[model samples]
Target: MRTDLLILAGFVAVGGYLFSQVWLSPGDRILAHSYNDHYQFEWFLAVDTYNITHLHNPFFTDLQNASVGVNLMGNASVLGLALPLLPITLLFGPSVSFLLAVTLGFALTAFGWYWVLHRHLCAHRIAAVLGGGFAAFAPTIVSHGNAHLNLVSMFLVPWIVRFALRLFRTTRPVRDSVILGLLIAYQALIGEEILLMTAMALGMFVIVYAFPLLPDLRTMVRPFLTGIAVAVGVSLPLLAYPLWMQFAGPRHYDSLGGLAYVTNDLNTLFEYSTTSVGNLGGTLTSTNYAEENGYFGWALLILGAGLALWLWRDRLVRTVAVLGAIGLAFSLGPDVGWYFERTGVPGPWKLFVELPILDSMNVGRFTFLTVVALGVMLAVATDRIIKASADGGVKRAGVPLRLVWAAALAAALVPLVPLPLPATGRPPVPHFFTSGAYKQYIAENHTVVPVPALKATGDMTALTWQMATGMDFRMPEGYFMGPLGPDNIATNEPPPGPVTSVLLDVAKTGKAVQLTSAQQADMLAELRKWQADAVVVYRVEALPQLRETLDPLLGSGRQVDDVWLWDVRALTRE
Candidate 1:
């Protein structure tokens, strides 16, 4: 085989091996967050259930329960960018569904990246291999891919870069724009948020480059409009669920309860110290430089910089200049970085704010733009370098380009060789949380029961099957009457009514109720109106209202079975 082909094959092999060693272990279920496990796993489980009961896969509707909230169906964004694996869940089950999705996502991303580089830059097979290979192993991709379908959508980025190149190089605007439109549609299928961000970046680049082509606006508009129509057509199915939810659902936007729950204060941005680098595979560090910074062809950035410098005398260079500036600004957090905090506002940050879609840009993660900029820089750089090489061989050069390449090769090998040594056992993830009660609960109850789960400790999977053991857990269904709390959202239900409101009509309300300030009076009154059989409160304090309110209704039979299984039947009329 040719050297480039061999190198490309090797890259694929390494990506596959790394995925198996790092991500596919039996116990590698929990992502960094518990919600990831619950949401993604539940989605997969729902797919399985839909196939079994409805005899079809509901790839378009991820909401499982429309009455409570909205959940978008995840499509493997890298491949043909479709929910191609939904039906697979029926054949294999949830675990296998996850495995297949990741594996297929990685493979599709790698292949698509290679095609983009080859088509756009006319890069040698080795360059294409390196580009795709490095992307497959990007630390952010690997780490976040544990549970995030959105991050994996990065596979489409290379294709976007490809379309950007087509717009620049040829007179085939009609063909190129149509292709670009298809890419947008595919990206939307994988992740609407990512698709939005990428489109914004591409649009800015196009407008900047369109000056020279302005005379032919008539020809350009046709393709541009056609591309827009095609993109909209492809995204209809994926958008249907979120659209419905935004108009009628609990949380219209992403949940903001975790680490990202930042205060409006600008100081909070700089105050957070977890930024630099933490426990990066056990290497403590003050600085965040890679063993090989700007590897995988940073030549592009240098080349682009040089182009802008040489063309400093011209307006076309302004395109590269503007993009470079935007990318750099984005890299600096709008509210945190010293540069952005003070100066970002009156400029690009204002642009981001005015555009609602850009809200998902998430200030600190300018890394996306940086990576895309790097690709552009490299493409421009490679074009220049090829021209230079054509004119004069490296041996006749003023600069030691060969030496630079050698140094880069050496740097890349140093860290990889010792790190993934076969002698060293595979990386370990601690199983800090286990559930004996959950396992016992499942083994004991094959039938669905209507009992609240015990205290709710660890992974939701361990808790989910436990909770669903007695009762058939269906979405959009409410059993207990109360205002919906955060805990209720996880189970796909709204909170019960306030305890006070549920007891307002009851003459024996004082005895049966244990009132708390948090419990709404209307809720208790409503519960009383239902003539409920029982009320179960996990927290002891929540029980006081119920106990006081039920005391008179119970009469001689003060039947309080337990917190998890309070016999509310006594509260109802005998």
Candidate 2:
């Protein structure tokens, strides 16, 4: 019937198909099992639960880091996302809520693109659909949908771009300025990196677009300035504290490290993956299965090149091309590589590496705009075909030019269509955490020191434990961003402190290591230092040898509800 309804139905059907595993899973099976999902999203849910219980202040929390705690904004401060999803978490549990947000993020993000292309840029609804679909199902989007909620939840990005353009054209500057401001402020909370990418993309667009209209630039300057003022005014209230906290907070740090490994290679961008069509044997050069953003496939690249060539004079096409080039350049990272081969010729990214705010960002994420630019190019190409035929002048090989372009577009998109995002079965959380047996030993302000305390590796499922129990108790080690140790690196992998690190390494190796009296004394002192009430060992393959090794040093632990726990409160009392 209507274009909006058609777009809506398409978004739901395709987005649902991609995330079918999550939506169709039986009862609590929709749990996030990815590395970041299990650790990061799980902990955020616990933080959200705590925030709701204690008014709306979400800056710091005791769930992670315990005493020093974690500054929420310094990390992935998803309060904008978490607050809205709170009802779902309360009703269906945190895992379900996480899956829901992820699944819906795809559809909403695509719809945002559709709205921009259909309402602002393209002449044909079908053209808009092509752009939106490609944007939503881009290999990179599905790659991230596996875990990273903030990256996937880019529904606001296109709108931000759309309104920034609206400022140049709108007579009602005040209204559009307010809209742009709200979008920026909300995006700052959800995807600050995405906002930066969007700004970069828009800047590239305006630089080229304004050149052609250089004489008219002064006419557009007032509205543009008004939009910026309104955006900063509206966003400053919420963003002010978090920006300061990230830079000046007690636990803030300068470096997060591992900058080179996350770089994108030119060959990797041309490569396909398990998610995309044309092949199932696609491989990745990025660290793991989760962070693969390189694939744009052969089909889109060819078709996009043709469109850019055909519409070379078009402002939007030129702007998209410039933005994509910038993304590719930035994605090369500080140490440039050619398809996994390090060339030793440093890229432009090295300049930004030493800069304050830019250094903290993952260099790999710049490719996000390349995907956005490609989607817009596809829409522009489709519209050109529609126009040539509607004018009754363009024909190719006795066929209407529109039909030819349409067939080519279909050919490109069909072979490159991506599969659903893959899902994995979650490991069971312990009954000690789930059954609430921990309540007896641990209380408010007291901590549960999970044995091994290896948060990213799933060995420290204590974050899940806190989320399961609605965060009734705090835990020492967890998956969160914080400045830690003497050098003060702000990272997800904070040291497990002295005590947990020694025990954890030995447990992982299953080695018989003699603990000296001094070592035993240090462990006990660390317990007191942490203000811990208890320590828990969740059922794992390494538990048996770990227990044998730790019993003599930490004293007898009680086994209850599928967990062995040491009540260290009495021993740690000063």
Task: Score candidate 2 by lDDT.
Answer: 0.75
TM-score for every candidate vs. truth? 0.60, 0.93
The candidate scoring highest on TM-score is 2
120-228, model 1: which lDDT tens digit per residue?
5566555565455445544333433444555554667667667655554447766666666676656655665566556666677677766667888666656665655
lDDT score of residue 466 within candidate 2: 73
Q: CA shift at 177, candidate 2, in angstroms? A: 1.2
Worst ten-residue run, lDDT, model 2?
25-34
The residue-by-residue lDDT of candidate 2 on 1-574, one tens digit each, is 4869877877878877877776676233433436656457756865876788678557777667777678887776577787888888777777777766776788888888988898887558888888887887787777787677888889998899888888888988888888888899889878777888787677777777788887888887767877878877887885788778777875776677543247777666777755767557765566666677767767677777777888889887887877876787888888888867888989889988878667767877788878888888888877777866887788998888877886887777665677776665555778777787778888776888886575666454556677778777777767777776577776676676767777677676876456788878888887886788888877556676666667787778778778888887788776
For model 1, what is the C-alpha lDDT against the true structure?
A: 0.41
Question: What is the RMSD, in Å, between candidate 2 and the native fold over all Cα?
Answer: 2.5
Shift in Å, residue 142, candidate 2: 1.5
**Residue 249 of model 1, lDDT score:** 43
lDDT of each: 0.41, 0.75
